[model samples]
Target: MKFLIAIALLSLSSCAVHHHHHYPDAPQTSAEPEYGNTDELYADEQDYVDDDEEPDSPAVAYPEDMPEEEAEPTTHQPEYPQYEPEETRTANQPKVPSVLQNCDVENFETGWIVAKCGSAELFVQTGPAARGSYYELSNFAATYATMVTNQETAYWGKRSAISVNGARGESTEYQFRAMKPGLFGGGTVDKDGEIIAHGIFTTAKTQHGKAGMLCLTYGSADKASCQRYFNALGKDLKELGRKNGPVMVGGVALRSEGKCHFLRPRELACSNGSLTWQGGSRQALENLVETTIAKWTDDHGIAGFYNPHLVTKCTIAGQTSTCHEVRFQGVMSTPAEIRHATLLEHQSLAVMCTYSTQESAPPPCTKFFGKS
Candidate 1:
C-alpha cells in the first residue's frame, strides 16, 4: 500500500509541474470582441454620379462648425426680384395747368419751358443772343396765336411798348409790337376791341431766377382785360397756376441741362419691400431672360432697331445686370431725345444697341452704363 501511494503522489506532482510550465504568461490577447465599438467602419452602399456629371453651379462650402446634417445643400438657388404693374397717381398739383405742373423751374436750364393752364398751353424757348435788336421771334407770332385766341398774326395791327409784372411783382419792360390788328376789338373775340399784342424780352426770371428768354402774348375781351397782362404779367401768369419755384418733377434732360434722370432698374421688392423670400429662386427667370436675349440679338438687335420692349426695366442701386442706351446717329436732327426703350433686369443690364450713326454697329453701351 505504501509503495503504490508513493508512486501515485510522484505522478500527480510531475503532471501538475508540467502543466504549470506549459502555460507561460505571454501577453494576453482577446480574440473575443471588446465591450466598445470596433475601430473599423463598414460604409453603407451609396449611389453617386461620376465627377464629370456635376451640375453647372459650383458647390458652396459650409462653415466648419456646421454639422453635416444641418448644412444647406449646394443645389439651392438664390432668390431674385420680380416685376409688377406700376401704380400711377395724379399730380399733387391737380388744379395747376397740366403744362406748368409738368414743367419744373429746373427745365429753364435746358433752354425750353412747356406748361399748360386752363384751356391754354405755353411753350417758351430762348433764342440765340441778339447782336443789338431783339430777334424776329421766329415762332413767336404762331405761338401767340395758339396760346391766346386762334387769330392769325395778320389780325394784330396795333403796336405799343409795355411793362409787364412777373410772378413776384418785379417789373420787366418789354417791347410790345403789333403782329395783327383788330384781334380784340368791338367786344369781339377776334376784333380790334379784342386786341392782341406780342413782344420779345430778355429776363433772368427763369426757374430760380436763371437767365432766359421771355415771349409775351396778351389778349382781352376788351381793353381793360388786355391792360391787366401788361400791369402784372407775372402775377397774372402765376394766378393762372404756373410754377413758382424749382420742383422735383422729372422731364427731358436737354444738352444745356447737362444731367440726366435715367429710369432706374427693376427691383425684386416684395409687398413688404424685403429683397429676399424663402424658397425664392432665380434659375428659371435667368433661363428665360437668356433665351429672350439670344433670340433678340439673332433677329433685330444687330440692326440696332430692337423690337418693342417686352418688359420695362429701371435702374437702381446695388443691382447687377446689363442695362444700356445708345445715341443713334440721327440723320439731320438728333431728335433732342433719349429713347427709354430697353428691357432691363438691372441698370447694369442697360445696353446701347448701336453707335450714334446708323452706319456704325452698336457701341459699348454696355460698358458706359456698367460704370454707372
Candidate 2:
C-alpha cells in the first residue's frame, strides 16, 4: 500500500510541474489607444509656404465632417409697467356748490300748531324758533292764524275774543276774533255773543306760536337753557294740541338777527334726536338734499325726512312775495324713495311736509329787516 501511495504522489507532483510550465505567461495581447491626441500628426501644405503665400496664425479648423449648431439671439422684456391713479378733479370741471348743512329740529325750540281741517285733512304746522330770540313768537302767531283761516268754508272756523300779551310791541292786552268755526264741536255761536271756543282756541294758538319763539330766545342763551325750554314747551304744546293725532305739518324758520333776508321755512320732523326732509326730483338735486339731511340727522340727534310726493321750494325774502301761494313740491315716489321712507319710518317717527317758497321778496333796506 505504501509503494502504491508513493507512485500516486510522484505522478501528482509531475502533473503540477507540467501544468505550471505549460501556462507560459498567458500569451501577451496589445493595449487599446487613448481618446484625444496631444501632438500634431500631419503637417499642412501652408506650413511649408514661403513669403509669397500668406502666413497662417494657429488656425482653429473645425471638422468639416461634423454637424454644425446655430446660436439663437435672446430678447429681454420687463415683467411689470408703472401706472398713475386718475385724478377726480379736472381743470375744466365745474366746481359743485356747497349745500346748506342740515339742522336738528329737535335741537331747536319746537312747537306744533295743528287745526283739524276734518278727519281726512288735518292742517299741522310745527314751527322751530331760533335759540334765544323773541321774533319767533310773532312767526308762531302769524303762522297759526294763517293756517286757521286758509281752509275752505266747509272747514272754516272763527276766533273769539281772548286776552293777548307781548303781541306787536311790549306786553299789551288785546282781544282776538275767530275767522272760522271750531272743528272741536260746540260750534255755531250766536252772532251777538262772543264764541266760547275762542278762549281755548286763541290760547292754544297763541301758546303754540309763542312756545317756538320763547324756545328760540331761551335756547340761544345756552344749550342747557334751550333743552329746558324745549322740554317745557314740548309739554305745554303737546297738552294744548293733544286733540291732533300723530300726523302733523312741521315748519322751520331760520331767522338771522344780522340780516333781513327771509328764507323759506323748511319742514323737519323730530323724534328720537333725529330730523329729516324730502327733496324735489328736478335734477340729481334730490339726492343732494336727501344725503345732506341724512348726514345731518346722523351726526346730530335729529332724524331724516322722506316723502315721494313732497317737493322743496326756495324764495329769498326780497326775491318773491307770494310765499303762501307757492305750493311745496318734492321728489316723486320712486323705488329708492319709497325704500328710504320705509327705513325712516321703521327707524323712528318722521315729520314730513311740503317745502314752500315765498313769492314776495323782502326789500333789501336793512340787513336785519325781515330776516330775524
Candidate 3:
C-alpha cells in the first residue's frame, strides 16, 4: 500500500511540472471579447463619468476576461445643477417707483385713467379737468408754454405753440414738430422735482361740451412708440369716455368721463368731491354691507371705517339699493360721518359713498347717488 501511494505522488508531481512548462500563453487577438484588456476596459469605463461629477460608489473591479454574455455598458447619471431661490436671485433688483405704483385722479372729466408702462416708455393722460373747456385750457396751456419756453428758445431756436383752431373734435394730437429734434415740448415732474416724462398733448371737447385734455407722455424718445400711441389715441379716448358701450348701473345709465386719470383701473376706484364710486360685475350681496365697507377701506387706503349701521334699504328701478351710515375717526381732521350706498343688480355692484364732517347737517350720502 505504501509503495502504491509513493508511485501515485511521483506521477502527480511529474504531471504538475510538465503542465507548468508546456502550458501555452493566451492567444493574441486584434479584437477583445468584451473585457479582455484590463487597461483598455478601465479607460472605456472612465469615459462614462462626467468631468464635473464623481461616481457616488467605489470604482468597479471588472474581470480581465469577463464572458461576452455577461458584459454590459456602464451607466453614469450626470448630476443636475443646483439653483438659488428666486428671492435670492432677485435680491439685487431695484424696487418700482411709487409714482408708477398708483395712478391719481384728482381733476378729470372722466373718472377713468389708464397707464401704459414699459421698460422705455410710460404714457399717462388725464381726460379733461371737470371745470375747464378745451378752448380755455388750450389757451391757458399755450400761454403757459410761451412763458416757460422763453428761456429754452435761446438754445432751441423756436418756442413751442399749440394748434388751437385746427379741428374742434380732433383727438389731443401732437407732431414731433419741436424746433429742434428730440426736444420735448412739456413734461411732468416727479415728487423729487425730476422731469420723468415728456408730453405730446391734444385738447378737444367731450360730447357734453366738457373740455378734454389728453397728455400722451413718454420717458424715451422712440419715434416708433410715439407713432403707435398717436394711432391708438382715438380708440383709447373713446373707451375712456365709456363710449365703447353704455355702462348701466342699477338701470341708471352712467357716463364715465374716462378712467380716473390718477387711479389704476384694477383698483376700480373713482371719486367726485367727497363721494367715491367703485363698480364691478361680480355678484355682490344685496343685504350685506360688510363687503362694501371692507373693499372701500382696502381700496381707498383710508383708516378703517366703523360704527356701520343701515340708514336706508329700498328698491331703485327694480334693483336693491342700500345706504349705510359709517363713521371715520380722523387723526387730525374732524371725525367725519360717511354714507355708503350699494346698488345691486343681477351680477353688478356700484358702491357710491360720501362723507360730511359738519355735525349740524345730515350725511350727504343721499345726494351722492344722484350725482354718481
Candidate 4:
C-alpha cells in the first residue's frame, strides 16, 4: 500500500510539470529582422500594422514651424497686332490744266494775236513802241476787240485783256519783228495816214522796272479761223510770263499829277517836281551793283534795274514845285542782295507814301498802289 501510494504521487507530480511546460500562457517577443532582408516577415507584419493595431514602425514627428512646399505655376504668352506702310506722292509729277484744249484762240491779226481761254488773257506783239502810242492804238481796237470777239465766240470763256505793245527799234524788235510766227497788229493811221505795224508782244513788268516781251507767232491770218491758234498762243504766253525772262531797261521815271500817276520805264525829261534819291553812299551803291551783276552771271539769271525814278513821285508844296523823283542804280549783286533790294524797295515805299491824315505820321509807300 505504501509503495503504490508513493508511485501515484510521483506520477502526478511529473504530469503537472509536463502540463505547465507545454501549455505556458506568458507574452512572446519576435526576433529582430536583418537590415533589409525580411520580405516575408515585413509582408506578414503588414496585416498586423492596421485595424487599430499599434504601429511597430519608429515614430516620425513634423515640426510645427516648418513651411510647406509650393506648386509651380503655368506660363502664358500674349499676341500683338500687325502694322502696314502708308502711301506717298513722288516729286517729278506734272500738273495738268483744268480747261479743255479745244477753245483756246479768240482772234488773230498782223503782228498781234489775242487769245482767251479759262482765266487767261494773251496779247502778243512784235516790237518796242512808246507806251502811250502803243496803248492808244492796240489796247482799244486790236487787243480789246480781239479779246471781245474771242469771248463772244467761245461757249464758256471769261476774258481779261493783257495789253502787249511794241516799238520798231530795241531788243523787242529783234525778238518780235525778227520772228514772224506770232500775233501781229498794225497801229491806227498816224496824222500822216500811213498804216505802220505797231509794237508787237506782251509785256511782263518786273519789280526792277524792266519789261519782258512775250511773243506768240502761231496763229491764223483771218481772225475768224484763229480760235485754236489763239488758245495755243495764250497758253504759251502764260507760261512765258511765269518764267519772267531777263529784260534790259534803258531808263525809268515816276510822275504824278494830283491822282493821275504814271510809271515811265525809259528816262524822260520831267516837266514838274523836285527829286530826292536814297539807297546808300555812292561807293556802297556801286559795290552792291557790282555784286548783283556777279551773282546774276553765276546763276545765269536777269538782274532788276531799280529806277527809283519809275517808282516814286512827290509834288512840292509850292504851286510851281517840281515833282520829286528818286533813283538807285546797280550793275551786279548776289541773288540774296537782289532779293533784299526788292524787299527794301517795297518797305521803303511804305514809309515814303502817305495814306492817312495823322500829323506827325508818314503814310506807307505801298498805299500808293491802292492796297495791292
Candidate 5:
C-alpha cells in the first residue's frame, strides 16, 4: 500500500508542472487597431480624391501657446507707355513757303544774281572776308550812288543798321540808296522811314571763316516782299559760308559828313569815333598819341588826356591788341569829364578816339573790345 501511494503523488506533481508551462491569455486584444484610428498608413497607395469631393477631416485648431506661421511675400511690376520722336514729327510737317525751300540751291550764286522767285526778287553776292560787324557792300553802293546821283549817299551810322534772325543764323542788315530811283523802290518806304530808291544788304560770316552778302531793293508799295526775299538770300549765304572758307571783302568805303575814308583789312574807322592805325614801334605810337592828345587839349584850353588804365585785350586782324581808358578833364565841369578807349598793338597800333559824357567809354570803344 505504501508503494502505490508514492506513484500517485508523482503523477499529480507532473500534471501541475504542465499546467504552469501554458501562456496567460493576451490582454483583451481585437482585430481592429488601438485608439480607434481609421487613417491610411501609406497615403501614396490611396486613390486620389476629386477636387469637388468633401475632405475627410476637419481643420484642427492650434493651441494658444503655439507660434503662428507667416505668409510668403509677393512682388509686383510696373508698366510704361511710349511716344513718337520729335525729329520724325518735324520731318512730316509742311513748309510755309515752298519757293524759299530751293532758293539755297536753285538761286544760289557766287557773285551777284537776281533770282525772281514767284512774286519775289532776290539779289545775292558771296565774298571773301572774316565776318565783321560793318556792311562793306553798302559802302560801295553808297559810293556809286554818290557819284551817279550826286546826292549824299553816306551811310547813316547805326541808325541804318538792323539785326535780323534768319533761318540759318544771324545777319547784319544795312540800308542804302540805290542808284536808280526805281531800282528797288517804286515809291516804297524802307524800315528806317526812308521813301527813296532804298535797298537792303545783308551780311554774315560763315562758321568756316568765309563771308557772304545778300541784297534786295524795295520794288513796290509793300516792303514785306523785299524783307522776305532778303531773309531768304541771307539764310542761303549763311549756309554757304559754312562750306566756303574765307574770301575777299568786296568793297568798303565810309563817307561821313563830307569826308570819305577808305579802309583796308584790320582797319576800322568813322568820323569823330575812328580806328586810326599807325605803323611804328609800340613806344613810338604811345608817345605820338599822348603828344597829340596833350597838344589838342592845350590848344582848346582844356586839361590833357592822362592816366591810362587798361580795360581789356582783344584780337584784331589775327593780332593781339591792348585797350586802355584814357581820362581827360571836362571843358567846364567835373560831370563833363571824359574817358575814351585807345588800343595799342606791338607791331601796329590802332587808336580809337571817341567823345562821350558817360563815366565809361562809348560803344565804339566797348564794341571793338568785345565788351558788347
Candidate 6:
C-alpha cells in the first residue's frame, strides 16, 4: 500500500511540471488576450501607466511642418463730398430772389384771374400764399415759371405795372407785371440788389392759373442764367402804354404799345413734371375755365385757353386744325393766339395738351402770334 501511494505522488508531480513548461514566458495578467512574452507585456503595460501617471504633459505625437494662422480683414469708410444748389452762381453776377415754393395746382378753371395782355394771355393768383419746396436752377426751356406779383398794379385787368422798391430814384415803370428770376435789364443798379432780369406782362392773373403754372415748374428757375440770356437776346422791353407801336413777331408787323418781349422760344425747355388732362368740353367749359373747374353742368361752358402758338398743317380728332383756325381782324389791340391741342368736347372734362418750346412740340407750334 505504501509503494502504491508513492507512485501516485510521482505521477501528480510530472503532470504539474508539463503544464509549467508549456507556458514558461506567458504573463500572469488579469487582462484578456494575455501576451505570449512577459517582457513585451511589461513594456505595453508601462506605456499605459505613464499616460495616467502624467496628466500635465501628455505624450501626444505632433508633426514638424505645421503652418501658421492668418488674421481676418477689417471694414472702414472715408469721409468727403458734400453739395448745395448755390453752386450754380458765378462771381460776376448778383444773386436774384429765390422763387417761392408754395404752389398748389389742381385746375385753372376756377379761383383765378386771367389777364388777356393783347399779345399774351396770363393767369395770376395773388395772396393766398402757399408753401413749396425750393429747386435748383431751372432753365427758360422749363415748362413752368414761378412769379412774384406786385400787389398794387399787378392785379387782374389793371394793365401790368411795377413800382421799383429800391430803385426809387430811377423810377422804372414796367408795363408788364410778372417776372421769372433772372432777366433784369442790362445789369443792375445796386450791385447787390435783385435785378429785374426779364419783363413779363400779365395778360391774365386768374386764381386757377396754378394749373398752367404748376405744369411748367422745374427744380430751379436759375435767375442768373435768365439774366445772362436776356442780355444776350437784347430785345427792347417797355411797360406797354396806351399808345400804339410796331412789334415784329413774325415776318408780319403786329401792333403793340408795351412792346413786351418774350424769351427765346427755343430756350423754353426743361420741365420737372407733367400734368394729366382730366377731360372736359372746349366750348362748354370755355367760360368756366375763366373762373372754375370745368364740370359740365347746364350753366357752365368748357374753359379752354387759346393755344399760345399757331400751328398749321396739323391734325386734331383725326382732322386738320387749320380749317378750325379763326382769325380776328377788327378787334383793336386784342390778344389773338393759336394752339395745337385736341378737345374731346363730348365728355364732361377737358384735358389740356402738353405744350413747350423746349423741343419739337408734339403737334408742333407751326404758327405763332396768329400769323399766316
Among the numbered candidates, top lDDT falls to 5
**TM-scores of all candidate predictions against the true structure:** 0.27, 0.21, 0.38, 0.19, 0.26, 0.19
Q: In model 3, where do residues sit more than 4 Å from their true spots?
A: 1-131, 134-160, 164-196, 205-218, 221-248, 253-274, 281-308, 329-335, 359-372
Of the candidates numbered 1 and 3, which has the greater lDDT value? Answer: 3
Q: lDDT, candidate 4, residue 188?
A: 16
What C-alpha lDDT, on a 0 to 100 scale, does residue 359 get in candidate 5? 32
* Winner on TM-score (3 vs 5): 3
lDDT of 6 by residue, 1-372 (tens): 110001111122112100001111101111112111000001111110010111111101111221222311211113111111112212222222122112221212111222322222222221111101000011111111212222111101111122222211110112212322334221111222232222332111122111111111112233333233223212211111111122221121222101111111111111210112223335543443332221211112224422223334644334333322222212324322112222333333222222322233221123221223
Ranking by TM-score: 3, 1, 5, 2, 6, 4
lDDT of 2 by residue, 2-57 (tens): 10001111122112100000000100101111110011111222211011111110
Lowest lDDT sum, 10 consecutive residues, model 6, at: 17-26
lDDT agreement with native, every candidate: 0.24, 0.21, 0.29, 0.21, 0.30, 0.19
Cα lDDT of candidate 3 equals 0.29
The candidate scoring highest on TM-score is 3
Q: Model 1 off-target regions past 4 Å? A: 1-90, 94-120, 124-162, 166-207, 210-340, 343-372
Off by over 4 Å in 5: 1-199, 203-330, 335-345, 353-357, 361-372
lDDT of 4 at 214: 28
Number of backbone collisions per candidate = 45, 48, 15, 48, 4, 58
lDDT of 1: 0.24
Model 6 TM-score? 0.19
- Using TM-score as the yardstick, the better of models 1 and 4 is 1
